[model samples]
Target: MLPLESRRDMKIYTFENRTIDIRAYSSAGGLFTALAEIVLNKGGVVYGASFDEDWSVVHRRIDNVADICHLRGSKYVFTDINGCFSQVCADLKDGRTVLFSGTPCQIAAVRKKFGYHENILLVEVVCHGAPKKEYWSLYLDELLKNQGKTQDEIASINFRDKTKGWKNYSVCVEFKGGSRFIQNHRDNLYIQAFVHDYTLREGCTKCPFKNPNSKADISMGDFWGIEALAPNIDNNLGTTIAIADTAKGESILDSIACRTYFSVEQVAQYNPAIVKSPSVPLDKPEFDTTVKAEGFHYAAAKFLKPVFDSRDRKMSFRNQLRSFIYRVYSFIKNR
Candidate 1:
């Protein structure tokens, strides 16, 4: 039998209404905004992942709406907890409501570390596994070199920048020089390898958290297939797919103002990460070997270009069909 955390008693929804300033990262139906507003209204604290000046993903405490807004968007890498659990417990014990978000493994770790707290709300992302921090560090260095900027000059970076729209997301990096670099996921070697699962951590391939039932009060992810399910709701900025896994989670959804309910099967069909782990990257050994002996750039050029090219071609063919499906789903959903 699946563990209790792996069980799926969830209510899915598409979040649409969003406040204006929060639109940047809240593109996916403003789920983060909704969550943030709830925490703020309760005078609670938010604990979520954000990037350091050096571009490493790490968890931090967010007290104000401005800081919580930073927690929007995906880091697309493994984030170290770095005592976030201890802090969350501390806040909850102080009678503050806490909204904690992370990958399912991180969520499980939080559960193991702190047991249960009524004031704490756990939100887990449908993760695609994590790559070693070393790989990301190296990739960032490569970006710095390409941009001719020092790590200290970096002002911000968004891995899931929606400038090109959601389906064709890009990485946008800002520097103190007022310079910005934006490149599509397919064009970026790091994202290419990431999306293909070539550089994921070992535990990810056999992750135990890939069950429909999760320990988190809520589960959230991009509504990747929203066009098919609710065409009227998708405007390309992004749409969010949120699942309330517990009664607490459900209650919070009931209180939120603007949202559209969806079926569990409809959501699961588009997002398998909710129930299954992705296959291990076939070229991980080669990637490891070449990356160790040569470097990230050389290894990526050699091992990843062909893979990315193939994916580009495949997606190109399917884009039209996917569009059709979205229209069909919208028709059905509205009717």
Candidate 2:
């Protein structure tokens, strides 16, 4: 196995004759701009998650390159491999150069299922982890209940909105009636709780892929604390940090245009601890047991309830406080 640390900071690597780097923040336009560079220089397909018409999840295949415009943003849902694995694997088998973007586990799953197809390039997010499916179900249920609408009435959802920043980061839920419900990230208790334990996959916490062992050529995530490191870069506009893990990864960076690339040394200097240490273990006990369990779904559902319930109470308290504040503000303004 390659020394895991070798792939820690974004470097470049080559896969299936194409080169691309995990990028630092590229604007909504920047994502497509980079993909366009890849397709024009070396014809290939781009695959990533996109929001469906109903705001559900689907794997997107962009052969024309222009279609990449559809998959921009941090909130493209359904990072789990369960729903979209077969389709993704099939595309890999087709032998076209493919850029598969997703959370690490989903990338790992595709790598495991398809093996290393020479033409496939895997790009993973620096994921905080994923929320439990139950939490999402309950959240949507609560939303529907509050709105007096059915699940089908929901049209789209955006989990992260840069216009609002993280605190005001809102989930925009649209309805069939053309009305929209903008729930602040804080208002979505289940989502907040889910973020805490979402990296539930057994192998993920131990994350063989967390380092260079990852099959992906490039890794992408928010350059948290970027301001401290790249004081020159305007993070307020949002930055996507890319860590190229291999030579092919480096080549991709060379190929892509529009992104303001930073050096690995600069990235390490910004996040000294990440450079100083080994990749952290996944750290969740439930994650260790779920994979070996007879039924992972049943086991996860059974084990995660207590954790979610405890969070629910805390969320409820916070919500009440918010409601009280809103009401007081309304009363004063009206008077």
Candidate 3:
């Protein structure tokens, strides 16, 4: 099969039929978890980004059904797995199927390390650029200080908490005692910085592995314009935009025992980020300076200026209009 961009018949879909629990907890439609299940069921080891003891995002290995939950959600911070690169190499050498997932660049690095191994399935997220882990640490420190809580008092931190619903996903800091802190993206500085691309790494500005370049088996992300693209399945729960680059990629997608839906054409305008690198916010340098001098809190308060999520509303309206015109054009052309 050709690259996702070069091929007109690229396989793209939302894993609507994925297990209910998995879909409910996932960042987007539980596609990764579903895929991970397939590999795990086959006795393969899955490697993915997960939060560590300090709530720092790091890539870890998952081999059992119980451990997949840890690798289930999205972590916006940068993660390096060079330490586990050799471990993955050993896993592959020992004739085990390895499902390695990460941001596009991390996938590229792993793909380079292993060359073209048939047993190694490279799955990359449609990354929005990884923010530096240092900033994430700073935010946690501030959150702890503000709440008068310590890291030990927290049980888990979910960046994509869907209690309010997927489209309006919030950040949830669950304490061990049962009480938790939840904040919507509108009020969440860390999420706003990530969404506005103000906290992303410098390399993400001109990402080399933009679209057709990543060459991973499967690339997935939140189906941003799902309301316009696949309305029937748009439950405001969660949906994923997925694309396959190679024949194996397509095969892996075909193996999914889920209600897959959509076409490549319907997905592109909805999620051009899969094809384009994240644009750098103009104040990123100043934001970085502020962050280094003060902290993520000060920098975010000063720089992350989003006007009441009007951009999301505007983008949705524009997507609906674009889809309407495309439908009209297609109807007339076919007639």
Highest TM-score scorer: 3
> Per-residue lDDT for 1-335 in model 1, tens only?
11234334445766655564455565365687678777977789888878876689888888887677678878877888957767876887788988888889988888777666777788888787777788999888987897788889888888878777777888889888688988988788888787678788888888987756477877877777777887886778777777777767777776773446566677768877777787876777888899989889888878887876787789987998899999999999999
Q: Residue 50 CA error for candidate 1 (Å)?
A: 1.0
Models sorted by lDDT, best on top? 3, 1, 2
- Top-down TM-score ranking: 3, 1, 2
Better of 2 and 3 by lDDT: 3
Candidate 2 lDDT over 195-282, as tens digits, reads 5454333343454455444566666655555566556754354555665655566566556522444565565454432233223235
Error of 2 at 317 (Å): 19
Residue 174 CA displacement from its true place in model 2, Å: 2.7
Using lDDT, give the best candidate's number. Answer: 3
- Indicate whether candidate 2 or candidate 3 has the larger TM-score: 3
lDDT (Cα, 0-100) at 153 in candidate 3: 89
| CA deviation > 4 Å runs, candidate 3 | 1-6, 257-265, 306-335
lDDT of each: 0.77, 0.55, 0.83
